[model samples]
Target: MLSLICFQSLITLSQIWLLAVMSILWIIWKSRNDVKFNNFVISVQRAIGTVMAWIREGGLLIKAPMGNSILDVQILHSLHLKGIPRRSTKVIPVFWHPPIADWIKVNTDGLSKGNPSIAASGGGLRNYRGFVKGFFGLRLSIQTAFFVELKGVILEVSFAWEKGWHSL
Candidate 1:
């Protein structure tokens, strides 16, 4: 019975050694062949690497931009605190994005009579020189705000290209 137990232990040790060697060989082969992993796995690895790289380089707060835009955002916050009237109380902050102040701020207002005084739809686009180039005002009812915003952006971009503005 002792010999049988010894034999079982030897078998187990051999199996473990075999697994170790096989894994080493597999790793070596994978390295030599440059094995391609599943796309999802590769994507996840890239995202993780990017996050790790970002952390290693610098944290978000440190890497954040220090520019006039930041000052403007701060001023806007201050204005809100001081109860100052400003254009459009709500804001959607898009950081690390290109500025429309340099591009073209397309101001828009609309009035439709069916529900309210949205009868006057007014939209204007600014050129690269920050001058008005194009204006669009559509008087319509039952239109989603999403649609108007999208159209405004499209018009702005279109005019920018038309006026030979380079998109960086």
Candidate 2:
């Protein structure tokens, strides 16, 4: 149960870090006058949509017809037993309550740590407002963070559309 809390805290840091990178990326986007950010954003968004659709079509969920939700739980348990980041148990909390139709609330975050080069971002979507939804925490290279963040936004928007909610 507490592992979930640690996971959330890491995601928060990942969000802050991603924002900083996005600000820097703004400069990169500005350097190229012939190109627009929409190109990158759009490509990633399309990719995410396709991947999610694939998940649904292929039944990729744990104990759920669409996907294997328990895979993440198992991975987390493995990491915990292996003492990965053995000290991430201390993380500050942030309160959030997102609105969704048909009882959905999500909490997302980004996480990056120096040692062992871990960078991940994920969240949970819940029906009961207080329950956890889905989570993803991955060890990443610095360059991958950009890709991951982009996918994160893409996944977010795509999920909203799939749920017939307004994300715009």
Candidate 3:
């Protein structure tokens, strides 16, 4: 019984270690691809931190301390030696403002499935108090996102005009 328990524990520990290693490698690959294709470069520390968090979130390393993986710790130490910031926590919030007293604000949006696949456009008109005056949505045939977006604007404008909302 003791030998069986020991074997199971060893297997579990190895699995966790394997997951940790794979997580780091996967993150590096993804970050490399992002830099290559999107021109988005992330700091070494950020990449390690992201993978650490991802592994933790996936419950793969539940017993390990956050950001305490051996590889991540090593990379983080190197980044610190290079005087890079430990982490960047930048959050920008969006706030909506009401229209002026007599004017109604119209907001529109377009969504495409596969860049040039099925699409839809819709919009709503809101008063200064944020009350919805009218809203609409429609399915469209395959089209570019830009075209759908333009269609959304045109639809909103036509709707507002028909509703005698010229001040918007």
Q: Which structure among the candidates has the greatest lDDT?
A: 3
Scored against the true structure, residue 166 in model 2 reaches a CA lDDT of 53
Which pairs clash in model 1?
A: 111-118, 111-119, 112-118, 112-119
lDDT of 1 by residue, 12-129 (tens): 2333334445545654555445545532232446544554444323222232222223333353243232112223447888743324555655566544434433344457766556
Cα lDDT tens digits, model 2, 53-149, are 4433322221211112344345334323111232334689997664654666645565555433456666556654455544445445653555656
Q: How far in Å is the alpha carbon of 163 misplaced in model 1?
A: 2.7
lDDT of each: 0.46, 0.46, 0.72
Measured against the true structure, the TM-scores of the candidates, in listed sequence, are 0.28, 0.30, 0.46
Candidate 1 whole-model C-alpha lDDT, 0 to 1: 0.46
TM-score of 2: 0.30
lDDT of 2 at 122: 66
Off by over 4 Å in 1: 1-102, 110-121, 127-130
The TM-score between candidate 1 and the true structure equals 0.28
Rank the models by lDDT, top first: 3, 2, 1
Give the C-alpha miss distance for residue 110 in model 2, angstroms: 1.5
Model 3: per-residue Cα lDDT over 125-148, one tens digit each: 999999999999989999999999
Higher-scoring candidate on lDDT, 1 or 3: 3
Error of 3 at 63 (Å): 15
**Candidate scoring better on TM-score of 1 and 3:** 3
